[model samples]
Each structure stands twice: as C-alpha cells, then as structure tokens.
Target: MNSSSDSDFFDVIVCGSGPAGLSASLAAVQSGARTLLLERLPGLGTKLLASGGGRCNFSNLLPEPEFMAAFGRNGRFMTDALRTGGLVFIRSFLRSEGIETVAEDGFHCFPSTGRAASIRDAFLHAAQKRGLTVKTSARADEIRIREGAVEGVRTAIGAFSCRKFILATGGTAMPALGGTSKGLLLAEAVGHRITPPLPAMAPIPVDDPWVSELAGVSLPDARLSFTAGRLRGSCRGELLFTHEGLSGPAALSLSGPAGRAWTEHRDSFRLILEPEAETDRKIWCERIDDARKKEPDKLFRSVPGRTMPRSLAARLAALAGLEDRRNRELKNADRDRAASLFAGIPLTVSRLSPMEKAMAMSGGVVLTEVNPKTMESRLVKGLFFAGEVLDLTGPCGGYNIQFAIASGRLAGENHTGTLPLEKQG
Candidate 1:
C-alpha cells in the first residue's frame, strides 16, 4: 500500500490481484467508485499467468443451467453473478479488449494467443486506461471493520480507508502461484466462517504399485466415483495414470471431495476407476468369453478390449491372476475376478497431492454467510467476496475462472449495498 497515493481512501478496495480481484477492481471502477486494486505479489495475476499451463482456460461454452450444475449443490450461489457476467459477457469483454478466445475442444475456452499472459496483460492495460489505482506487493494484514460494517484496510506499509472491500484472495492451492490464506484470515477477523481449505482440481496420489507402473497410460475416458461430505458422486472424463496415482479431468474432478473425505473421515475410501460409461463386469466377462472362442491362444490380458492400454490391461490381469494364462484357460472364478478388475479398478489413494500441486482448493469462506445475489456478506455490510476464496470448487476446466470473473464483477458492481436494477429485456 502506498502511503503517498494522492488519497489514502477510496470508495472501493479490492484485495488480491488474481482473476477475481482484477475483475472486481474493473467493475467497481466502472460502477463509478474510486477503486484501488491491491496485489501481494510483485505484479498482477501471477497465478492466472500460470493457469491452464499458461494457456488460461478462461471460460467455457456451457449454458447457464449446466454450467451451474458443474459446481454441485452450492453452485446456485452464483446464479446472479453468472447471469451478470457469464460466458457471453466474458467473451465479449475480452474481445472488446483485443483478446480473442477460442474453445479449442468445443468446450474449454482458451485465449487465441494460447498464452495466459495475454489475458493478464489485457486486465493490466484496461486498469491503467481506466485509472484504477493498483498497488502491488501490498498485502492486507488487517481488515478494519467499524461496528458491523467494513471501514478500511491496513497493510504493513500504510492504512487505506474504504467504503467497501472485496476479498478475492483465491484459495490455498499452488502457493507458489500466488495462493495464500490472508484473505480467509482477514474474513475470519471480521466475523466470517471459513471452511477448512483442502486441495482440489489436482491429482490424487495412490500407493498402488501397479498403478505407478502405468505412468504414461491414458484412458480414452475414465470415471472416478467417490463419496465426500455433501459432494458424493462421480466425475467422468479423460484420465491418465501417473507415477504416484491418477491425474486428468476425471481424477482431478473427484480429487477435491475424495481428499477431504479421506483426511476428515480418517479412513481410506475406495477410488473406483471405470474406463468408460458402458463398462461393467458383464461387458468384460462377455469380451473374455468371446476371446476364448475366437482367439483362444491369445493372452487373457489382450482380451480386455482394443481401447484398454496394454500395460494397464496386463497389470489388471496380473491382479486377477490371469496375466500369464490364455483366454481359454480362464475358469469361472478366474474369469469373474478378471472381469471385475477390468470393469472398475479399485485403487487406494494414499493421500491427495499437496496444495502446491493443485489448480484450486475445495474450501473457503462458506457460501451460506454471503449473499449470493450481491456477493456481499450477510453478516457484514459493505464486505463482499468472490472467486476461490468462497467455498466453490469446479472441475479442472474453465468453470472456476468463469465464476471468478462473474462473482468478482457482481461483488464490485454491488459494493454500494444494493443490486443494480435489471434492465427490462
């Protein structure tokens, strides 16, 4: 915080310079508030510059309903925000700023330049053009609350008063990528409940020795089913086996709840990996049976299917004690065991990968305490929240970023403590 700013106070102050913070600052400025954006890092969007392997999956093409559902039970909290600044708005906004986006796979959107720096630079250039005062390396140490409302913020350098403040400090995932808990701490000091921040959108490490051997193996599509707290379900998408465990859309989508359930419950849960939507024990059994009559001399492992990775098939076959046997040599029990292994391989996750490896976190300021319509705290007037700092975690794609932009915009635009009158459509 610069004590030498022409004024030490502003109408709106947004903390953290990630996607949410940048968006909040822009929206506040546009809403006619004298706004200031603060960043703890040396510059803006350090984490965002590293998102999507630097490609920056900014948003997606999912419609409102399906987009909201991707976030599970608490997704509805973002209804207003999403409506205010969903994909259409985001894409148009980027285009207005000379940044074109493309949904390369017809879903996950990326900047046409394929560089996250382009997106970050767009925000930087726009902020400069709009005269939104942004101070870097200014970590908010304390959020000063007057009575029951927000008053100002104090950093090690200086204290800047504000009529309202927004917390977009993001989550504790990828600490190296500008992730920290300062925003959560500040919220806690001012009477906000914070969920235990857990790693999400990252790989889950397992102790299965055979899984480790299939490090480079990729499944066409994989399904990971688990029960974690209120998020009990399955995630289906592409999957890749790693030296430690599973990584890819499927594993990453389920990692959040699975990790939380494993640590919180103090019990190891089964991580079921089904290779495809139609795959089941019966299908595997039939495949094996057909192979016995058509190619009886072939190895049992080769009977899994043409899509199954050779190494993974062999490993699963070995687990069923059928690796070295011919398809014709499989007895009923052997065939059943092989079918089960092929259908859904149960892998034991020793532990979820650390926060340093995660794309985002599962926990944050619980959604209940904040008003979804305005992104404002129900407990504290003039205090608002956006982005990963809230208890909203999406799968490994463009969902989280889209929420950040939308929620940040809502929080910033509504900093005056009221919703904007929706124009008659």
Candidate 2:
C-alpha cells in the first residue's frame, strides 16, 4: 500500500533474490533487458550461504538422464530447461565469474574455494556488473495484473512496472532466510494453480527418546526405508541422529513421501535402516553365520559395525533383545533374531519437521499450469516461475540448485517470446 509516483520501470522484474531470482536477473541483463531484482531481505542469497554446510554445492556433473532421475516423477518436467541450461552451463557460468568448481562424490559439484559466500558474492557481482538494478528490503505486496497480464509488482516502497515478471520467490523453506508462502499467494491471485505446499528434504520426527540420546551419531552406507501402512520405498546413503529425530542424506530423501504418507496414515509410519550390503537377507544370514563362528565373544549388536554406526549397532542389538549376550551365547533362534534386527531397524516416524527446518518445500505452482519448455505461466501472460515455487522440487544434493538455475535461465531467455500479454483479455 505504498505510493508509485517515483517508481522506475524496467524491461524485466524478478522477485526474490535467491539462486533462481539472481540467475534470472543475470540472464535478463545479459540478454540486453533492463532488469530489476527485488528481495525482501536486506541482503541477497541468504539461503545460498547456508547451503552445503556453508559451502555451496552448485550443481552436479551427472548426465541429464541421471540428474533428472534424482527428482523422481517430476524429473521429466525439467528436461527441456535443463537441456538448454544444465550443469554444463552452470559450471561454465561459475568459471566465468572466477568461481571455479570441483566435482566431489556422486558427481556433486561445489566451489573450488569451499565457501558458499564466494558463490553468493559471484552472483551478486555478476548481476551488478551486468547493470541489473537490485532492491533489497523490497517485498512484493502484490502482482499488479490488468487485463489478464502482468502490469507490474506493488512493493512496500511503490509500484514498479515491467514488461515481464519472473516469480522466483522460492518455496516456504528456511523462513529465517525469508521464505514464505507469499509467492504462492501472489501467483494464486493471478489465476495460477498452486500445489499445496508441504515439507520436503526435511528431517523425520521420531518419538523415541533413545534417538536423542544418540545425537551426533552418524551412520554411513545405510539404507533407510519409509513405510506408510502398505506403501513403502527406500533410500540408501547416510543418516545422522539429531536431538529431534533423524537427518542426513538418506533421511532427507525419504522425507517427502514419508511426510505425505504420515498425513494420510498417522497410525503407522516407519523408517527402517538396513546395512547397505545386507539389503539381501541371504547376505546378512551368511554374515551372521560367519560372525557366530569367528567372533563368538563379540556381542550380537557389534555385528552391525560391519554395516551401520557403532551406536546404531548397539541400539539394534538392544532392540532385538541381544545386547547383553555375546555372539557365542546366541542360539540358532538368536541368530535369526539378530539378523532380523540388523536387516531393518524400525523407527516410528511421528511427523515431519516444521517448514522452517525443512531444506526445501514439495509443492508450489502446479507444473501443468506453466509451460515446461519456457517456464512461463500459461494462465498468466508475461509471468513466469522457477525454483522451489514450481512444484518441481527434487531430492537433496545439488539437484535443487540445478533446477533453480536451469529454470531461471530458461524463463529469462524466453520471457519476451512468451509475452503476448495483450491476448490475455
């Protein structure tokens, strides 16, 4: 509700200054468009600075097919944008900004400097160098739509007009970094269909107090399976015990489906941690047999050290009622019990962590409402969306950033071509 008399217009206006917004602004400016980048926070890329434990994992080097697979079912929607603006382009862009990248395990890429701030500064520098006008502490109050086309955005300061608007306002994650549902609300007011937002890439809440007692214990090479009543799926990697529940790669990957399942079937939702190698019960049985003969003095719980964390091993053993007994003291039934415990350590998942604790959100503008090729809104002319705001969230790692930058670039480059706003009437 601010005055607009002194507001300046631009060829392109981008809301939010996260990875997607900055990337879009950069692309727009590079394309010879007068661009304005608006952010609600006092500084830009607040969330980016906190990613990858303070070292921004920019993108992954995997092929498009492999990269897309990480996104699950919504992966295909990103094929077009990624094909045009994929990891290759992102790597090249970062290099151009003098922020070199190095590929780590699983083809995950991070800044050579190992500092997320470096990547953030690089984006800000690029945007400034390209003459993109950036306005911080400028939250968009509304998207001014006239005749079914975007006229401009109304901010706290005033109304700023633009030929095209890019809503890269991000999803409702990391609220401390300025994420809110306002972006979805703005889109909805303009006739865009929004997918109900839910927490994704978040930690699962376990009610067991023993989990908190084991906080800081991390298990690598473990597989986590999430089961909601009859539905079940599994992810294999690492898990870290937190005071509230479980976190880390495997736990985060299963959070989305687990959260959804928990909502529908609150009575029963479980997280099963199995030794990565013993995913096959036969293999576990053989290992149990070997342990019984070779290391009879070793506790049954100690057997999991070959597969899970020492802490997890002890917990599993205790769960199977074999923590006190030595491996040699185990009867044949005890061996079966130990194997069962090692194969799947079930933790009752109570619920999802709050949105503020979520790494990313699952829902946003439905994909069908936007053109996958250009990221332009089919319902609202001259308006486009990218990043977590688009109901296209992928698993944790570098996939989310890749999707954000790819979609941003695509929307920026295709903005003008998709802006036949006069027909919106």
Candidate 3:
C-alpha cells in the first residue's frame, strides 16, 4: 500500500459502495466534484442483491407522511429530505439510467427486470461515464481529521486526502454481506456517539412450546403487539410460527421495539397475537355459539380455524381448556373462554433473533449529530453520514433502502463549492 499525494486527491470521498455510497458518489461526481468511492468488498451491493429475496425492493411509493412514519421517532428528521423529492429523485435517477421499476401492491417498488444486478450495474456504468474512481476491496481503516474538519481517510490500500468525506459503511447486520462495526468505530473516533445497536427487522423467539409444534404455519394479516409496562410496540402483517419462535413480516418489523422492551426488563415483555380484525371477544364467543347450534357434533378444535390456522386453532382450544370436548359438549362458559383466547393469545417473547439474522439494525451514529438536510455531521465540518450507519431504522417494505438513497443523495448534492450537474439522457 502506498500513500497518494495532492495529484490523486479527490474533492469528495464516499466510503462503502452499497446503495447509499453509490448514490453519494454519483451525486458528487455529477456535481462536478472529483469523487472517489471506497468499498471494502470485492463487489458492490452484495447485501442488496439479497433484498426482497433477489427481486430487490428498491423503494416504496408510499405518500410522504405514511412512508416516513415507518421510521418512528427518527422519521421526523427526514422531513426536509423526503420533502425535497428524495424517493422520487432516486426513482427518476434510476429511470434515467435506463432501469425501469414496477410497483407491488401499489406501494412497494422493484426493478422491472426483478434483478438487483440491474441497479448495481447502472450505478457502475454511470460512475464510469462520469469519471468517478471506485476502489473495491479497499477497506477504510480510519477517518483522518485535522482540527475538527475533514482531512482524508486511511485505507488498507493507502492513505488518500479529500476535501470532504461520507461514511456509509452501514450497520452490523447481515454480517455475511460485510456488515460490521467499522462504521461505529469510525464515528466514535470522530467524536460521535452511537446508540447501542440492536436487531430491528429480525425474527423473535418465544417461550411457548407450541411454537415448535406449529412450525411452518403462517397466518396472513396477523397483528402482533409487544408490551413492557406502558411501552408498547405493534405491527400487523403476515406472521409465521417457527421452531424457535415467531417470524415473517409482522414479527420482524416489531422486533426492534420488543428487543428494547426485553432489555428494559426481560420478564416484562409479552406478545399478543390475533387476527388483524380481532376486536371483540364477545363476538368470537357468539360466533362459536352459532357454530355449535348449526352443527352440534362439530369438533371444538376446528372452530378457531375459521379465524386462524388449524394448528393455531388447536393450540388456542387447548389453551382455553376446551380442546378435548366437541362443540355439543361445550358449556356456555367453555365457549366464552375459547373465544377469549382467539381474541388475544398471549405468548412470552424470549428475545429477538441475533443481529446476524436481521435485515437491518436499530441504532448507529445518533441522528442529532448530523444535519438531516444535508447529512453532514453537525460536529465535524466536511464530514457526512448516511444509510444504516445513522441512527435511523425503518420497518420492512423498502423503507431502509429509501433512507439510504435519500440521505446519500442529500449529502452528495449539497457538498460545498462550485459545481455543474452531469448531463443525462
């Protein structure tokens, strides 16, 4: 490894060439800055290729308020960025690069070709045409700062100087795709505080024995709520019973809150699972009574399946102490108990799945330390942050990628000095 002098210096250096760094580098070069993109991996977008099971859920088309709300408290910080056409800008940028997108369920967006490689290749082609220098397999060792301002970065390849720098190394999730604590370490070195990172979009473990019995059973439109005293977190989507616990969209989205609750007090965490439309326990009881009248010989275990999976129905019947009886043998009290179980089946949450299995993580460089408008560090001039490296985590359904692209776009577009926008076809 050899150090580079002034001749090789760049106007801006973007670290990590995932979605965020790619967007940042493109924005910087398009702004007429001599930009350099540094990636530790041999290839870019490694984790990205696995998103949406390879279909690549690039972004969502949700309206601004609804989309931002998915991020919880930090969502407010993205107001100016999203309002400035962040999501739209990314989509438009892709379209300009000849990559088309299709919307799923009128909200989730994916590449028209259903390939993550298309987006990755588009970025590489654009960077090359704009003369952006990308160094793959070059790990950034340290961020150099001079008297509270950006100086340059020390990488495994060599030390290089830059007028500005952006850290988009991402959070410590999906370790197989290069996720690590390197970003957190770099931020700490630069006088930034990082919140304790936890698994966000990840599966959750439960203490119930039925979890294993019902493994592979999936419930669509199930509502899961976790409560720790007064603090509560909830999400409604598909839920899956796993050998160890619960999974699928709803459980994964709710893991962040549940993980925090468990940390507050392990035994305080409790999860309630029910059909999304479950509201009145009495109504369920009445439905059961009607079923008993319609067919007195019907099996009690088969009753709950009308609202949930047959396996779940059996479990609920057993929980309510009515599984051994037929509908005709059930007394009014037994009917009520069975109905109540269906309304809200309580499950003890053991903990969240390990971070390695999570899609994204909660916690990173604290949001307050960066200027949300430009993603530039408020404490360190000429230094910026973006993507999962920041203290922002969103629910499943393309929100994370949207934030990465938006934050990176803002950082690169607003980089200081005179510049010219690269002409596009």
lDDT of 2 by residue, 81-107 (tens): 897678888778889988788886757
Q: How much does candidate 3 score in TM-score?
A: 0.94
Model 2 TM = 0.90
Model 3 global lDDT (CA atoms, 0 to 1) = 0.82
Which candidate gets the maximum lDDT versus the true structure? 1
Superposition TM-score, candidate 1 onto the true structure: 0.94
Between candidates 2 and 3, the one scoring higher on TM-score is 3
RMSD to true structure for each model, in Å: 3.9, 3.2, 3.5
Model 3 weakest 10-residue run by lDDT: 416-425
Comparing candidate 2 with candidate 3, which one achieves the higher lDDT? 3
Candidate 1 residue-wise lDDT, 1-425, digit = tens: 34346347777889988889888888887776777888888878998888888999988888888888988878898999998878888888889998889987898999999999888778767766776888888888998888888888897557888868899999999988888988899889888899998899989898889888889889877788875444466889888989888898888888887877877764545678787757788988888888989998998888764667777777777888876999889888888888887777777766679999888999999889999989989998889999999998888788998899999989889544433322111
Clashes of each: 0, 0, 0
Ranking by TM-score: 1, 3, 2
Q: Tell me each candidate's TM-score.
A: 0.94, 0.90, 0.94
Which stretches of model 3 miss by more than 4 angstroms? Answer: 1-7, 276-279, 418-425
Best-to-worst order by lDDT is 1, 3, 2
Deviating ranges (above 4 Å) for candidate 2? 1-5, 104-106, 229-232, 277-279, 295-298, 305-310, 415-425
